[model samples]
Target chain A: MLNPVIEMVDLTKKYRSFTAVDCLNLTVGKGEIFGLLGPNGAGKSTAILMMLGLTEPTSGMVSVCGINSTRNPIEVKRKVGYLPEEVGFYDNPTGMENLLYTARLNSIPESEAKKRAEELIERVGMAEAKHKKTGKYSRGMRQRLGLADVLIKKPEVIILDEPTSGIDPQGVRDFLQLIVSLKQEQGLTILFSSHNLHQVQQVCDRVGIFVKGKLQSVGDIESLSKQLFTESLCLIEAGIHEFPAENTDTKPVRKLLEPINGIAKIEHKKGVFEIECTSDLSATIAQTIVNAGYGLNFLNKKEYGLDEIYNRYFEGGIQHG
Target chain B: MKEGYNMVKKKVSEDTTGNQKKVKRPAKEKPKHPFWVIVNKEVSDHVRSWRFIILVALIALTCLGSMYTALNNMGDALKSSKTGELFFFLKLFTVSDNTLPPFFVFISFLGPLLGISLGFDTINSEQNRGTLSRVMAQPIYRDYILNAKFTASMIVISVLFFALGFLVMGLGLIAVGIPPTAEEFLRVIFFIVLSIFYVALWLNLSILFSVRIRQAATSALAGISVWLFFSIFFNMIVDLIAKGLAPSSFAPEYVIVKFQKMILNLMRISPAQLYSEATTTLLMPSVRSTGPLTMEQVAGAIPSPLPLGQSLLVVWPQVTGLIAVTILLFALAYVAFMRKEIRSS
Candidate 1:
């Protein structure tokens, strides 16, 4: 069994009467990108802060690298790199200078720190802005620089809270790609929180969905999809305003898709039709739609995107709570 | 397929192992990095800051200006054949035998401003820049952070005070054409301590206000208002109280006694007044002797006058109280800042 790098066993954080994180349990294994998917105010940042031991948990246990975070926060901090959602830095210091300072704070040797800073700066695509004062950097640029700062110690666990929250489209893409590269190249264990569903789904090996301070689901996206909706779904898009349209009994309907396998049921709404399957048949249906004379408006796997997952879990959690 | 499963299993283990590697070192022993790093950063930033520079420069300029003014008065007094003790003493201020040196006036007024400026924003700027939380997140204890700040500010204030003292001594040397005798030098050191204490008392007051009042502007205003009340308005109130409260049949001698008692009482509560009194005692030899004395000795008596032991006794309370209050205020700041949740966004 894989050992958990960061684990929270019924971790709870309360601000007075308001419970910000309620009995939250989570685990991110080594060398995997774990997406903490949540909407704003869903306690994602609170959980991240608790993992870093910046905020004390109201109850339960939090351990980073098997070291109890609350009992030994400084030890936990040394092992984890945290990039807060809104990254702030010393405005007077240059990007490189700030990273060097943070490296010193983390007790990295000066010579090795310089080398790592240079490496991470380039890795984060911040080499061009390395010498500029962080005060003058754009939001995306600041986030990139912040990531570079967090990596100064080459921390064993990287916890980034909404790392791409306010960046532009290209910036978000570049940021996600960098995280992917880090995961692949460094085997970095990352616990990332983001509202960007596509990016999280694309990069995360497993995801934990949080809503209203509650962890609603935690699994690989495929498993989560199946567990949440109880079947594999395919979004079938076609022209002529209906599915099984007028030719329901035709050979095309029967020969094209009926016998493939694992489809449990089908439903239609507006221009899109949903196919519930015992096994994923997204490719087969897309091919079938393409081969048929029907105009294939859109055909895609019905994985819950981050946005839809947030709406489903977050809104539902809010109502439930 | 088995190999693939094994690889995935190994990947997870590696991630956990990597985390374990980082946590092992710290759990085994306390990290020395956070304490040294914060102390170095605090000192370096303060040393390079504009406020520190301005503080030093202002002290130097004020010392030079006062020295020049003192020299001009000395020159005028010497030109007149009345090189008598009373003439020189009066010339130290109003060129009359009846008053205190104007230089003491400058010390009382200038010292508190320097003190207030040093402390009014020490905590506020860190909070404003959002670095306070980050600084606290380090492994070093919270008291160390406040200690470093207080130590850095005191170092700056001390440097300015001593530099100004030296500048005055140098100016006195050039004008009088003699290095201060050892006695005069001792007296001058005592007076400098007194002056610095006056400023430090205000500095401590400002620091306390800084902690109590969340806004830097408000803390500054509080420092200034207190300084103004003591420097300008207090004397008038003291005189009014003395006059109204004194018996109509009170003789001139009795009046002097009443006045002296009232003045000492007022100076006890106000550091600026204490500084002025101490400065008078150090600079004017006549005040030391408790009778009429010469003028050149007023500035001359500063360098070294009484025995070192006696000088220490003369200003011991001022020095001790100032430092005590400074420590007390910083303690308050430390407690408040530590209790404050860092989520002050």
Candidate 2:
């Protein structure tokens, strides 16, 4: 990492007999968007709480902005804005009032607190509803105010635990875009925790897959795919104009392509042929099919996305030891 | 040095606001102390709450009603009194018609409710609203929340007690056509102070329960249950125990006297007992002792009304007892709240 803003070293949190977060080691660099991806009960929230010093770890250390969270929680909290899962505000107070209360708690002077609150409410698209009581807001509206609340303190790092859990799909996209822009514009290091795989893939510069109170893997998508899927190699697909099995030429087309280097197996599905290979054999396979006078329409290589990786690792059990 | 963050944030906001800075105060004003900020917020929150309004109305109406009753019967009270009481101003609080209780009696009954109402939900309601953890995540220390809460409620209770006390004294001035002597004025002030501590005891108990119980309703119920236990059944239970160990009525006279003293000490464990004992001594000048005195001890005591200092000395133990229990319960709340996990669950 270029410059780690958040570092968790052997951090563990146990509740009597059961551990909520196991020994976890991870580092998120400056201005990086790191997604803490996990299932519902995978200790993602617990780890976030420990990082914000809202919960004490059973052992080891977690730090933010070079400050040990347990030892100097108030200082850590001052620099890191944490929006917990199912984040809530004082229901009786208007959204603006809640933000002001937070700003006051942070010791922001009255006039400055108001100015920041207004700008943030506008930034998070909560300007129209800022005057409304939070109890009357929908789930999506509450999330918007929550984001504004986090930004009011002008924190160096933002930790949002499941910020999009209850929002509509379009709102989630906009929220993700806002945070990414925030990272770019203000140079903020954001630690976003979510169970949403596709969304995490969309925004995070790197991802950490946590499972059953343990982190299974942490890296960018391409790096994680390369690290976890090297044994299975890659999948290649080719389409030819006359590729259906009803045509008697299909067998000849299949027999003609057996000489390609690194080709592992072939499966015919409808009109497309799936060529499994141990390497990037798209070039060789395309050349042979064209050389055999078969008009190929399309050829493509399959890359592992987060969903596929999650399914593979989750199904196989994350703990190999 | 960390406090400078607020100044930097102010500059950032000033840039954002441009020409819209409406505040006339100097931009370089120091940040208000966070502890006082929280206390102010809590006090205003309580004052605005519906429960607070209802409590004020309830206590105020009962106070006026009891004062009216006292004024209506004051002539007869002055005529029938053997000591020929001159401090009629004090009578507004102590003299009650058969149909109604005095100001002190109403305080003994309603003061606990006031404390319980203000504080039963102080912790759990914030936790339930999901604001506690969010507020705790701020730069303030953990204990600030609990301490600010206790201080704010104490402020409210004190203001309410002093306001009502002075209002009665003011009205008593108009009704009786004579101002209270300095000693009478001091006695009323002492009575208000004692009532405040009496309420403080219950406030601490309720705040303690608020920290221990997760549900606001359950904490409120727990506080009310304890209040009811002390005010009603606790004395009866003490009586039953005393009867069980009554020295058989055949033991030595000293043994019987010691047994009686033990039972009185046991009854004082109830906060209501302590409050009433302290209140009676503070409000009434002629009343001398909270505990029984022997013939020789009473014989030397003149029938004259005790001075303000002497009265306070008499009520000192009950006052100290009330304050000690209040502080002890507050300590329990403070420790529990500090150790509590800030997770929303």
| Per-prediction backbone clash count | 16, 0
B335, model 1: CA deviation in Å? 1.0
Model number 2 iRMSD: 1.3
> In model 2, which regions exceed 4 Å deviation?
A237-258, A269-272, A286-300, A319-321, B1-24, B247-252
The candidate maximizing DockQ is 2
**DockQ, model 2, C-alpha based:** 0.62
Q: Cα RMSD (Å) per model?
A: 11.0, 5.3
Task: Encode model 1's per-residue lDDT on B46-112: one tens digit a residue.
Answer: 6787876786676566556655666666765567633243323323322222233355576677778
DockQ, Cα level, model 1: 0.16
- Lowest-lDDT window of 10 residues in candidate 1 chain A? A233-242
lDDT of candidate 1 at residue B222, scale 0 to 100: 91
Taking the candidates in order, what DockQ does each have? 0.16, 0.62
